[model samples]
Target: MQTYPVDIDPEQLIRWLEAKHAASPSVFRITAVRATDERMVPPRGTHLDDLDREDLREIATIATLEIAPAHASEGWLLTVVVEDEVGPRLPDKGALIEDEQTIDLVTFDQEFIRTGRGNASVVAAVEGPEAEKRMARLLHSIEADRHNSGPAKSTD
Candidate 1:
């Protein structure tokens, strides 16, 4: 499997994840902050300009995917920390936050690349008989999305 670099778009990743796993009761949270902002800076010798644009942007993103299986006592959590340059463009004090019930379908083609075991481990982490079905569906959806020409359709 290909390993996607940390520069992948957080929104796109979130969308792909949502597209494949929407049936399950899952929540995806994506937060982006400026790396050089006063709140994010350290008091040490490091200067904000010291870091390259890519690094600076990448250091700004915080993302988490949580899955709760139906009738299950416990759920699974998958978190990814990466960088992106898109945050600076967002309004609302250089931070963009998204919390929604359904995944917003926007074009995410080329935003993420297939990598690792995919999110199978995350699905497996859910404890219930439905885990296997969910896992299979997620895997298949991911594969289909990977080869598709455009972004996954938005359910909006």
Candidate 2:
């Protein structure tokens, strides 16, 4: 198996997450923005100065905006999942299908959304929407796989 590492800003991730949540406000919720890096994403640019709570909220909002009704209705969240590592509830078990080994963003339902670790991306990318769709498919696949996997194994 081949794998690669992806780097993303926490605040940006939060924004993206919240954006998706905005679509289906009734289903999803913005619980927390957990990350080891307290700084999150450094705000910059021709007009920007520094990262602030607004930046974080925007990041979360953008992420949430990317959420499609098909996925959001099922409680999908944008997250980063590394292989074989136990983390937060991300919805997917690291099953991602993409042309690139390392992608800036990926969607995990509940099995991979973790915090106090580097996973979500806070920086904006040119192909943000494309990335969102790709991740959405991955999340949909996770749900499908779970349905196919059938009953859980019992410890006896």
Candidate 3:
């Protein structure tokens, strides 16, 4: 997704995930993620001199996880099944995201809320192959844009 969803609710995410899991054994896969910052989409006409500490400030994860899935509660963190090959987590978190994982909705939702507009844009594929294909198409389109070379978010 692009800009952080300010009204994200962990409980709502859990409900959706519970419903999704109930309907089918679908996993919440995050295929591609690019670590970025608010500066990535700075206000038009702005230059580096216009930036501030917060503008340049970026948040890498402070924790890999809070609690195990089996022990997860609204008061605690949930499980995220991260796969191998991405290497260590970077401040951008691009490496972490690219490694791929099936994340807990509660954890993922809470993160977007807590981070606000700090974390860079990430590519999450929640609906499996269709989502993946859509992301590929979208990124492909982004790659075609002559004015841009970094990640972008589309609100529509």
Ranked by TM-score, the better of candidates 1 and 3 is: 1
Return the candidate ranking by lDDT, descending: 1, 2, 3
Q: After the best TM-score superposition of candidate 2, give how far the Cα of residue 50 lies from its true spot, in angstroms.
A: 46
Q: How accurate is candidate 3 locally (lDDT)?
A: 0.32
Candidate 3 ranges beyond 4 A from true positions: 1-14, 27-34, 38-102, 113-156
* Residue pairs that clash (backbone atoms under 3 angstroms), model 3: none
In model 3, which range of ten residues has the least summed lDDT?
A: 67-76
lDDT of 1 by residue, 1-156 (tens): 112223334445455665544543233332222222212333255444644332433223222243333324323223343233233322345564443222222212122223321121121343344543444443455545652333223121
The C-alpha TM-scores of every prediction are: 0.28, 0.22, 0.24
Q: Please identify model 1 stretches exceeding 4 Å from their true place.
A: 1-60, 65-80, 84-124, 128-133, 146-156
Q: Rate the local accuracy (lDDT) of all candidates.
A: 0.35, 0.33, 0.32
Task: Write one digit per residue (lDDT tens) for candidate 3, span 30-86.
Answer: 222223222133344545454442344332332222221221121112222221222
lDDT of 2 by residue, 6-81 (tens): 2444434434444444444533333322212112343444244443433431121111112223333332243332
